[model samples]
Structures are given as C-alpha cells and as structure tokens.
Target: MKRLLFIIALFVVPAFALEIQNLRVVPKNIDAGNVTRIMFKLSGPAKLSINVKGLNGASVTSLISNVLYPAGQFSIPWKTPKKIESGYYIPVITAVDQISGESVTKQIETRTAKMISLPFTTSDLPGGNKEISYSIDKAALVSIRVGINNGPMYKIISNWELTQPGAYSVKWDGWDGDHVIKVDQLANYLIDIKYIPVEIDALYVTNPKNISKKTIVPASEILRQINAFVPKYSVAVSNKKIASNSKNNESINLDINVDDNTLEELGDIPYEYVLYIDGKRYGEIENTTSPYNWEISTKNLSKGSHVFTLMICTSIEQINTRSFKVTL
Candidate 1:
C-alpha cells in the first residue's frame, strides 16, 4: 500500500494557470559596458516583452519585443547603455497567455550605484579666471580645491556645487582663502564628486552623429516643466554608431567571383548564422560543416541608396553588423 501511494504521488500535477513570477533584475546597480539580464519563470505558455523605464515614466530600451515562449525559466540578456547617468530605473515585465489572453505585469526597481573617484586626466592653463573641466556620466555635487606644486595644502575653491551630467568647467578667479591672488599662484587641482541618484524617467542619449542613440525618455516630454533647483544638465546622451563596436566581425575569404555581398562561414564546424538586411531579419543557414557562403541580391533595391546595415547573428551573444552607403 505504501508503494502504491508513492507511485500515485510520482504522477505529478501541472499548473494550468498562466502567469510569470520571480521576476528580477540581475546586479541591480548597473555599470558601464555590462549586460543586464532579465529573468523570470512562467507557469504556462505566453507572449512577453521586457523593458526598462526611467523613474519619470519615460521608456528606456525595449529589451525584448513581444515574443511567444513555452512554460519554463528564461533569462533575456540586454546590453546596458554605456553612458547611462546614475539614477533610479525600473525593469518592467509584461506577459500574456497565448490561449486564454490572461496577462500579468511586473516591475522591479533598479539603480546605478555611485562612487567617489578622481576625474579623468586633464591639463588646463590658468587665466585671469581659470576654468577646470571634468566629464561625468551623471549629475553630482562637486567640491573643488586647489593646491600649489611643492607648496601648501589644497584649499577649498567650491563646496557642494550641484553640476549637470556633461563636461562643464568650474571657474576660479585666483583666490586664496577668501582673498584675491595672482594666477601664477595656482599650480595643482583636486576635485571630488558626490552622486545622489535621481528618480527621473524621461531623458535622451544622443550620439555625435545623432545616429543610433537611446532615449530613456523623450526630450519634448521631459522639458515640459522645470521644477525649482533641479540640475539642468543632469541627464546626457551618447553618439555611438552601432557598427563599429562589434567583436565578431572577423570574416573568412572566398575565391569565387560574385557580384552579391558574400557572407563567410565560422570554421571547420560551420556554425549556424542568421543574417539581417536593412535592419530586418532573414532566415538562418541550416546545419552543415563546410566553407559555406551566401549572398543577398541587391537588383531589386532602389538606386542611389544612402545608408543601411548588414548584420549577422550567431548562437553566441556577440553580434556583427556593418553599416554602408550604397549608390545603386
């Protein structure tokens, strides 16, 4: 009878309910150039999308577009913004059952931790009013002190000056302990930054070329109202082109003479490669192990095209993409 009860218990029961649980943001204090993973468990098959939003209700990166999946554990990886200002953010997870349409929304608070550190190496000449510049990733309370080379200790120039998130210079009118001094008296500079994370949602990250930027919140909405004493330049954007920073761009050469752009294979074991043309995903190269190659036809494309991207993805996390200006 005990054996019979044990066998009956072995026949497990499955949950019919559809929902996502145990959602979490790994290493909540994000850093520069790190991958942030969103993890969760599903009770049933569903479609889900994950996103990060600034505290001001502005949507950051849409990490995962809506996709269907089976009931299981999942951890989706996303490349965190390289120059994200230290602030409060939220990871939003939304899921919907494929059959029943039942859905659930979950959120977890995440933030960028702050630290006191030396500024990047700088050398500036002293004038009538000397300006000392520093580049910071976020808004910080700055304290500037100046000292002479082989002379006296550092003296306080400015204390607790709230500055914006970009590279701004602090001006010093050659003062020594609340008294006027000559510009030649200045020799060395010591600066310290104190970070206090903000609960802002909306901001823009712009690149130098303004191409491939990420906006946690749109600029128009965030600038609608300016509260009293808020740091004007607390948020910043970057101008990074997506094509130049790929690690898996190494390609194999081929002897064949073809007009179409040919893609190279992995190696002895031809790993499956997926291609993207004009920002849209095409099919994948099936299983095989050889010096395989493929090309895309540009005959049907418009003439004198300016800019587009050719990207290739593999099973690994690193992706390769090339941007070009074609005149066809």
Candidate 2:
C-alpha cells in the first residue's frame, strides 16, 4: 500500500504553463554600426520567436522564428541593419509549450530600450513666419515641405540635401508657389530624412559605368554613388488637359523621365514616383523600367485650377518634388 501511494502521488503532479522572465536588451541605446543582445530566462523547454519592432508597431527585423530553446538562459545577438531608420525600437519575445498548448508573450521594459533621437521643432505657425529647427543625430539626406491641410504642398524647403549631425534651422517666408499663404489656411509641414549607407554589393551588381569594378573602392567614389542615389526626374504630360471632352470621363497620359536615363546609373536601387493632387496621393509607380507612365483621370476633379505634384522617393523617404499648376 505504501509503494502504490507513492506512485499515485508522482502521477498527480500538475503541469505548469509556459513562462518567461528576466528579459533584457543590452546596450539599449544602440549606436550606428553597433549590435544589441536580447537575453532572457525560460522556466521550461519551449519554442520561441523574437522580433524587434519600431515605435509605429512595425516589425523591423526578426531574430528567430519558432525555434526550440532549452529551459535555460539564452542570449541572441542582433547586428543593426546598415539602412535602418533612426528611431526607437522594442523587442517582443514569445514562448510556446508544445505539449501543453500554453504560450507567453512579453516586451522588454521601456527603461531598457533602443532609441535614436531625431530632429524636432517647437514652433508652429500657420503663416510660416517661424523658423523650423531639427537636430540630426547622424549624416543623412533631409528635405522639408509645407502645405495647407488636405491641399497642395506650396513650398519645398529642401530636397534630399546632405546634412551632417548638428543643429540646423530654416525660416519659411509663408509663400505658397504663386502667392503668400493666407492666414486662414491651416498649413502642415513634412520633414523627410534618411541616412545614406555605402553599398558595395549594389555597386558591383549594378556595374554602373561611373564606378569601375575593383577590389577596393575609394571613399570619394562611394560618396559619388551615394549622391547619385537621390532621384532626379522630370514630369511631362502628353496633352496637359484634364478632360478631352466634358461629356465623358477621360484620362490623360503622364510621363516621368529619370534624368539618369538608366537604372544602372543609379546603382539599380529601388525607387518610386508618387503623384499628389491637393495634398492627396493620386498614383504611384514603383521599381520598373524607365519611362514610367500613368493615366490621370479628371472626372472627379472640380473644373478649376489644381496642383499636380510629382514626388520621387526611395525606401527611406521622399527625395524631390516637381509641382505645377494645371487648370481644367
């Protein structure tokens, strides 16, 4: 009877759920060209997945996906991507017990986090009389645009301008392209910024005529390639007419010509052109052969003057804009 009781007691031990503890991200404030480590403890054997996400809740990268980890302390090293945007990031970890169908999810504490501070401005003026200021944490391409809410972007303060880490300020004269912005207009501003990285593989693969194949590429040549990455394009319309006839809804032919004429000239980098009308996105053409054409429909537009803006952009952000008045 004593042996039988001991066997029954052993079989009655309840199973515990999956658990994670002591989660940490070392070197919370990662610098450019640095690596971070994620460390954690598990109570029992489980499959785990770890991912880093930005402040906007977008997954930036995944360290591991559903990999089995033994019941012990584990550490994961993650090297920051060369072209990662400057901002804050959070590490999310998940663990699952296969047999019990139990799972646990947790994020690192805010105190122990990764962050890259960005530029900011304190003044807000509708008349555009105030000076916009920002601090660049690293060398980057920056641009600024201002416009009324849900209307045409009237002024472009900068266009893919190379800037170094420091404090910078620029004042706006409150001028829309044609005239001074009115006091009643509610204008909005956009600061497009992105860091540039030296891409050797891209240069080799693209085989741009400007950059010759060599075992070692000089810094000046690399800088030239970086500058070429900024999109230089021109916009043209076949007829520049909103409607061929008022009775029917007709589309107009729009063409965008890349100044370089060939993708190889730009290292075959991914890019796109976005068309905006009255501050709203109209159409977009992503990485494709040159001579991008889009059909702009004028059926919904009111019979008056409208702003037609063509913006060139890359994975990072907008590089340049070409805006003009189109009267229907």
Candidate 3:
C-alpha cells in the first residue's frame, strides 16, 4: 500500500485597499484539499478580482474576477491547491475604480503543505534499534509508536525530529523507557505516526479551519503553539486494538470485507467530485469520466471536523454524497 501525508497553507490580511479594507482569509490555515473563506469590507462600489498566485507571480486560481460589488462587507471563499507539492503562494486582491478603470492591488504571502515519504514501514521489527530511514522537505516533528502482536502500540520512540532535507535511520528498541520490548513475544507488529504538520501558511495557524463557534483563541496563542503535535492529525491503520498499559490484553486481528452486492454497486459512473469541510466548499473535480476513480485524503483535518464528498452523476442525474466525521 502507498502512504500519503497531509498538509495545509498559511493566509493573512492583505495590504490596504482604498475601497476595500481588512481583506483576510477565514480559518487562515487551510488544509490541502480544503477551502478558506476570504472577507473584506468595501468603502464604496467597486470592481474586484480576488486571485491566488503562485511563486512565479502568475495567477493560479481566480476566486473572484472582475466582479462588481456595492459598498458593504462580503466574504469570498478560496480553495487551496489540492496537491501537497504546490509550494508557497500569495493571495492578491485588486480593486478597479468603477468610473476610472484604474486599479489597486494588495497581496499577502502564505505557506502551503509539503509531502514527506518515510522509510519507516511495516517491516521494521522490535529488535535493537529497528533502523528506518526517512526524510522531509521542510522542518517537521515526527512521532512514531510501536505495537507488538496486534496489541496496543506504545509510543516507545519519538522526538527524533527533522527540519532539513536529508536521509537517515532512526533506531527504535520498542520500549517506552518504562517497558521492555521483545521481537518474539508477539504474533504481529504495528506502527503508528503522528507529526506536527508543516505550517504551510505561517509559523502558526492563528485561525484553524474548523474554529470553534463559541471559543475564542487569540492569534498569538495559536501562532506560539502551531508547531505542537495534534493527536487528531495522527494516522494509524490497524486490524487490532492498540494495546493499553494494562495487563492481560488479548490480541485479535480484524478483517474488513465487502459483500458481492456491495462490490457490484461499487462500479464507477460518470460524475463530478466536490469536497467540503464543515459546510464550506473547497475543492471540485469536474467531469470525472468513466472508471470514476478519484481520491481525496483528509489526513490534514482536525478532530471533530466533518468531510463531505458529493459525487454527482451527469448522465442520469444521480447524486451520491458521503459525510465523514473525524472522531480523533
């Protein structure tokens, strides 16, 4: 199986606008494949074009272009790039004087998610330092835990962090310093990882994409703690329940299978894929032709956020929508 990592980007309030002021992206730290909302207030009627540009100073995506609006506050939703490889970006908002056709531009720099391919895998065993190689494109905190015989995995080793690009092996003896581990004591082994995702937008995401409606967290606090690890972002797929520190826990492997009826219904039809998180629209793939196989990894989502996938069949007008709630 192929492994994938999740990420996001930073956003900020744009430079001053004569007719427009306080141009900012809501949930400033937008995850890969998720949407961020941009808001601003107008002093008078104006024509505006809100576009996100790549590093080459070229327009990547235009959220709003040449649209006229009355003097008032408004929000425009902007989608981040779907892929992690898209590096840093800038959001530029321009206003044209309705009567003169002259324009003013305001821009702000932001970060984007990066992907990492790790050498740590299912093959790493619990003998001595189970040597595993890994590398990252940017500074990141990587957390690794070990499990034995389909039982609870212990966070035996972590904090072997990386901030630069290089290849190296991190040895793990499979002990939490409080416990000892042996290779032959179990029937199967499991490993899990949780890394502080690279801040694609800023050093800290003052505003999380799924911000609490009632809770008010200051920007400074979010920035100071942005690099800290969040467990809701942890990734682990296993057939057995993670063993706890308690004694006498039995090990069992769980298998997942689909019925023939379900398999038959799984065939693809022509459709479009729309991704939304917490009731906000983010990414869309138009005309996903036959074989209708497309994928979006929400590994970057915070705990308690809801991911909605809408697959609309164009031929017969059938809509299949799935909503996944992240429980942690």
Query: Best candidate, TM-score-wise?
Result: 2
Task: Estimate the TM-score of every prediction.
Answer: 0.32, 0.41, 0.30
List residue ranges in candidate 1 displaced over 4 A: 1-15, 109-328
Clash pairs, model 2 backbone: none
Candidate 3 local accuracy as lDDT? 0.46
- In model 1, what are the clashing residue pairs, if there are any? 54-201, 56-200, 56-201, 205-237, 206-237, 206-238, 207-238, 207-239, 208-239, 303-328
Instruction: Give, for candidate 3, the lowest lDDT window spanning 10 residues.
Output: 228-237
Candidate 3 local lDDT, 1-328, one digit each (tens)? 1222222223333344456677666775555677777777777667888887643455678888899888789887765645533234456888887755668777653332332324454335644556655555553545455544333333435532323334445676644332333432445755655443344342112234342212121212222333321211111122132222232222111122223343344344333445444445556666543323334444555555342323232342222233333332
Model 1 C-alpha lDDT per residue in residues 98-214, reported as the tens digit of each score: 877878887753233333553643345556565666666664445454534432222355443434467766666665442423323544533333433323322223223333212
User: Could you tell which candidate, 2 or 3, scores higher by TM-score?
Assistant: 2
Q: Give the lDDT of residue 133 in candidate 2.
A: 81
* Order of models, best lDDT first: 2, 1, 3
Q: Please, what is the whole-model Cα lDDT of each candidate in the order they appear?
A: 0.48, 0.59, 0.46
